[model samples]
Every structure is written in C-alpha cells, then in structure tokens.
Target: MPRILIAILLSCALSWPGIAQAWGPLGHRLVARLAEPRLTPQARAEIDRLLAIEQASSLADIANWADDLRANDPDLGRRSARWHFINIGEHDCAYDVAHACPNGDCVVEAIRIQADILADRTRPDAERLQALKFVVHFVGDVHQPLHAGYARDRGGNTVQVNLHGKGTNLHSLWDSRLLASARLGEDAYEARLRLDPDPLPAGTDPYTPGAPAVWAEQSCRIALAPGVYPPRSRIDDDYLLQHRPTVERQVQLAGARLAELLNIVLATEVSR
Candidate 1:
C-alpha cells in the first residue's frame, strides 16, 4: 500500500464508531506514549517505516487498531476477540495452555504470534502492520489484572457491580473505570505514569520463555488480591484509593515491557 493511502485508511479506521475500546482510548494511548520515548533508535526507525505504510504518526495512533478490528470487522473481530484476554480459574495461579488457553487461543499466545510476525521482515507490510497493532493492544490487555482473571466470570465481565454509583461489571471497572476516575487526558495519564519514581522492571523479552505466562499470572494474582473483587456490588472511594497504585504500576510495567519487546524485534535486521 502507498504510504499516503495507508495513512488515510488509518485515519478513517480510527474515527469509525465502535473501535475496539480496550483500556478505553486513554489507557492504550498512555501505554503507547510511555513506550514511545523508550524505543531504541533502530526500533524507532523500523516502527516509523511501518507506520508510514499506514500513515500513522505514532504508536498511540495505531494502539487500538486491533480493537477497531473487533468492532468494525465481524469476521476478523470474532476470530480475534479471544486474543485480548485469557481466563484462568480464581483458584489457579498457574497458566497452563491446556486448561486456560486451549489451542493457543489467548492473549499470551497472541502476543507471541504477533511478535513473531512483526519481527519477520520477509512478511508483507500489511501483515506486519496488523501484527504491530495487536502487539500494542495486547500488551495493554495483559497489564489489566482482570483480563487474566477467572474464567467463570468471563474475566469479570459477568460480575455486575456499581462503581461510583454507576452500574458496571468487574472487567469493565478494571478496564476503564479506575483509570477514568482520575479524569486525566491521555497525555496527562502518560505523563503521570512516566513520572513514577519506582517503575516495575521490564521483562527480558515479551516473548521470552514463559514471559507472557508470567505476566498473565501476575495479573491473575492481582485480580485475586483482597478487595479487588469486592464481596458487594458497590465500590467506592476507599476501593479506588487502595488499588490505584497497582493500576499505575501495571501501566508502567506494560509500557516498559512493550518498549523492550519492540526494541528487540524491530532492532533485528530482517532481510528483504
């Protein structure tokens, strides 16, 4: 695709109604913006090349493309919706492919597949662009503790609750509510997270042996943490105050890990 045309298509796609609304637009952009400056020069240049194919300005612009795929393209969405999350039993801390991610149909697996595609230079630009979007989105998804929560509740989607007097579900609450409660724009959110004096360590590689699984497991533990899943359906100020730090930390970790992954994959010299 011509670079200018690709850019136009992305602009249209981003504005379409019902774009995959993960992490709310704010959260995904925050992750992308945070990762932006941390990218290695090689990775930055490669990313620029890929974005030029679609005419995107930055990682944040394409961060939610996979979600948009889910909303606007039913066939692709149906096939990829499961790619956004993994469901583990509340009792299970371990992420076993057979029990939790049968046939590799989960976020952890999706990250692996997308990273491989993005890393392979021989792949067509269109394919790599799609993979790049998936990597950007899934990194944010895995950071959300509920995305790796109990299968019985559909990762807390089915658990109805009232947060700040508004009816919502546990999954949605984690996905957007807490972050939204801060009332910060995407830029502010990214700035605040970047200012964290203590950031979580990035993984050696996002696709390293057991890395995605470990990320999922870490989120699972957070989901199972006390008060995360309240006994009652109503969550108020106290709840938000308690878990806010965890949310901030997760975002920081995700951004750092994403930069680490992109740095490794995009820095590799893929032969034409």
Candidate 2:
C-alpha cells in the first residue's frame, strides 16, 4: 500500500534471486540434516553460541587468529597460504587451491593448527570457536566435488555453468545450489536447525593423514574429475539428474563428518 512498503517488498523479492543463488535447495537439505542427530551436547552449545552472536564472522576471523598467533609466537601458528578463492580471475588464489595436497598444503596445515589449538586450553575460547567454525566450513567445502577439483581450472572457477537460467561458475554452483533448492525460508530453516547431531567418532583425528581432506578430495575427484577442464560447463537439469544423487550423498556425509569433528573437539566441554 505505502510507497516505502512497496519498495521494501520489491527489494525483498529481488533479493530472493541472489539468496537462491547462494543457498539453493540442496544446500538447505544438507544444513537441515546437519542440525540434527550428530552434534554432541557441547558441540551444539558452541554452535548455539555462534548462532547467538548478533553478527556473522567472516572466514577472515579464522585466518587472522592464526596470523595473530604467528605474530605473537611464531612457533604457535606456523601455517600459511598464498590466496583463497579461485587461483585465477584476480581473486585470492589461495581459495582456488582446494584443500589438495602438494599445491594446496594449507588445508592440511589448517587441520594441524586446529588440533594444536584444541589441545591448548590456554587459547581463548573466541579463537577456538573461530577455528572450529573454519574446520566446519572448510570440511564442508572440501566435500564439494568442485572444491577439490581441477588445479588449472581453479577448482571449477574457470568453468561456466547456467543455473536456473543465469550464468554462474562451477564453484558458486556447489557453494549454494543445493541449499537454494531446499527452499526452506530463513525462519523455517533456522527453526529446523535448532537441533544438533551427536558427536565426532572416537579416535578419529582429522589432523592425521588420510583424514577429512583426503577423504573429501578422493570423493570429489571421483564425482567431478571428468569435468575439471576449461569452459567449466553449465550445470543444469540434465547435469542435476546425473549428479544429484552423488551431491546429496556428499552433503549428507559432510554434515555427519562435521558433527563428528565437533564432537571430538568439544568432548570435555560436553562431558562437563
């Protein structure tokens, strides 16, 4: 009715497209599953604390904490990375290096750093939490077939794909495509995610070799290796038909694995 109201409504409607782009239906499916059955009591509490924070902290918080650790005591945080995002396109090349071995060594380094952080009770809870979130998010990313995909293609960035009509990159497709498809509006989405899963598997240390990253990379290579070259093909209905099942499986596995890792780190807190 009111002009301002109309503008607001229009803006909201317009924003949905972007929202859909970032958190597609499949992504929602994964998150919905994530918020259930796996997180231990402690992990859930930490997740709640994170959710309660009024503002969302970007990945920068995780990276910078390590930087500060390195600055304060070089031996404390020896991890380093050159860039993030696709290696090409003038963006942070570090992001492009999918937690892969040899070239993208930081991913493994991150796991070790996290292990170290968890072992030291002296570390600030805030920093610990930030690092934990990085582990959670990065683990999820690594599971994405494209995340551990081609080096030359910048892990699918060089590939162009059409998503629901608009042109998008392969990396963005995996980032948000599934969540967007779920169509669980924010309120409903958050409401459903109120619950957390059990805990991490016992004696399952992700920092060790052949852990989360290795597993994720192995899976991604299987699913996305064929399409890792240039011209990053557009992902559409046909592609979805063939790969949707694998995508769902990976998303489910990622959520479960993430819960497991949280459980391990928060064992003492949960037990207490």
For all predictions, the C-alpha RMSD in Å is: 8.6, 11.0
Give residue 171's error in model 1 in angstroms: 0.9
lDDT of 1 by residue, 179-235 (tens): 887888777777778777736455544447367888999988999888888889987
Task: Give residue 137's error in model 1 in angstroms.
Answer: 0.4
lDDT of 2 by residue, 243-262 (tens): 55555556555666655666
How does model 2 score by TM-score?
0.58
| Model 1 TM-score relative to the real fold | 0.88
Model 1: lDDT of residue 151: 72
Position 129, candidate 2: lDDT: 67
Score every model by TM-score: 0.88, 0.58
In terms of lDDT, the best-performing candidate is: 1
